[model samples]
Target: MESFADLSHFLRSHRLRTAPAETGVSTGAGPRTAPCLLPAELARAAGLDADRYADIEDGRAGRVSLSVLHALASALHLDADDRAELFRLGASPGTSRLRGLGHLTRAVPMLPVIAFNHRYDITGWNLPGQALLAWDLDWPVEHVQPNLARMLFLGRATRALYGNGNAHGQRQVAGLVGALRRAVEQHPDEELTRLVVELAAGSREFAELWARPAEERSDEDDCGVLFRFEHPAVGLMELSRVVLEEGAQNGEWAVVFSPEPGSASAAALDDLLARVSGRPC
Candidate 1:
């Protein structure tokens, strides 16, 4: 079995293989052309000497610093949870979990909150989350397998439900892979390590992005990603995401969505829910 150390090494190697062009990092490159961002480009983006940045990714020299990690996270466009994971990996293993980490997810506000782990498996969700998705809370987590990426890519209704579906799906996939990379770095013994590798192999886009170093972002700013949804009753809806975390359990993430108040999208969501459940909107 692979240890956490082995997982970390695998993550680093996988990250290095993905490059800028693979993730649509366009700088006047033709659509057919995929360009690799050399060490200098990465160094410049991270505000480090090319050799120093290379050494860090290579695991040959230099300590992983917060500033450097932040820079890389920005360059890679990681979401909040993924960024937090990176920070955890950069810190001493014993000192990684933050105080009050899972509080937000556990707390039930008006909105729906669905929690997933680093591997994108559903762990828990609030009542609203169950209602929004029209899911039965009593179902087994494994049976639901509430993976946003998987749902978007494989679910029957996902494409119809999300406007900007392609971009939204790509971003979510990239973000999940980024988080997985950090998790592999922190806990190689994790069973999800092989699962991630197998999934990446099946996706060219994922394989490409997985080869590059990950980027990080603050949880607050990372929450909202713009998209649109199409409901059978609602027609079309504009949407955004809010991600909440619950420490470092390896598979915990919270995702929520909202439409503008009093907007058509909101009304549509209400109507759609009512129609689906035969309840008043």
Candidate 2:
């Protein structure tokens, strides 16, 4: 049950432990003979003052330059997916028009268009969303719980699609629990209260994060989830999820796509999209 802070710490540690060799920097004997580099060493390698970088790593600061994060990721030799995740963790959430639409929800033009309320309940979804979810479009949105966090852990297809299901599920639950805590602080009510209680009751991981006072919220703009899916007919693919907020009701849209061009998965997704749109598979 790692909080976002915990995940940040883990990533920092992982980066430090793997930096020296990857960066091709040798720690000249003496007292600095450790295999891994410290925050200072990492900072030095990335051409920054160690204290400032340490502040960012310790969560004392809200802003982190993307250039710095990228430099660090490159120094650490992170793969494309991990590098993208690092950059995402540093971006700010963009403001949107769909921020205050009350309880009503409507899908935007984003791929896999879906909308949910502050409680993470599904309110609207487009055709592409139904295809991606493998869900029946005829059903009422109210009948389906659209909480992405809940579905990642509870839904068969979603869970199976997330290759590192447990870790990803826990991280999302922690984030949603963190959001719920903020909502409670602003305006306590029956629905928000009930949703919190229900989520706690239903998910052990969510309960654990809820029990702990939430750490500082992550930069919503910088956070992304990676999902790996294997369709019955399309084969295997990986998608990077980008969450965009719509209105004041805390409505969100998640868009998924492959990172690499001309890959089998990309071809498969394009084919699926064509078929779903009544074009061609």
Alpha-carbon TM-score of each model against the true structure: 0.48, 0.46
Kindly list the per-residue Cα lDDT of model 1 for residues 1-281, writing each as its tens digit: 12234324533543566585544444454453434565556566557787876666665543465566656656655533344444444542222333232343345344555555566554444444545553322321223245554554445565345544377645655666677687677656544666666656665555777798778844644567655555544577665677655554543445777777888877766665554443211
Residues 171-253, candidate 2, lDDT per residue (tens digit)?
65456567667667764668768777776788675677778966886565233555556554465666666555544444343
- Residue-pair clash count for candidate 1: 18
Candidate 2 deviation (Cα RMSD): 18.5
Q: Measured by TM-score, how close is model 1 to the native structure?
A: 0.48
Model 1's lDDT to the true fold? 0.53
The reply for model 1, stretches above 4 Å from the true place, is 1-110, 126-144, 154-169, 187-189, 216-221, 231-233, 246-251, 278-281
Best by TM-score: 1
> What lDDT is obtained when candidate 2 is compared to the true structure?
0.53
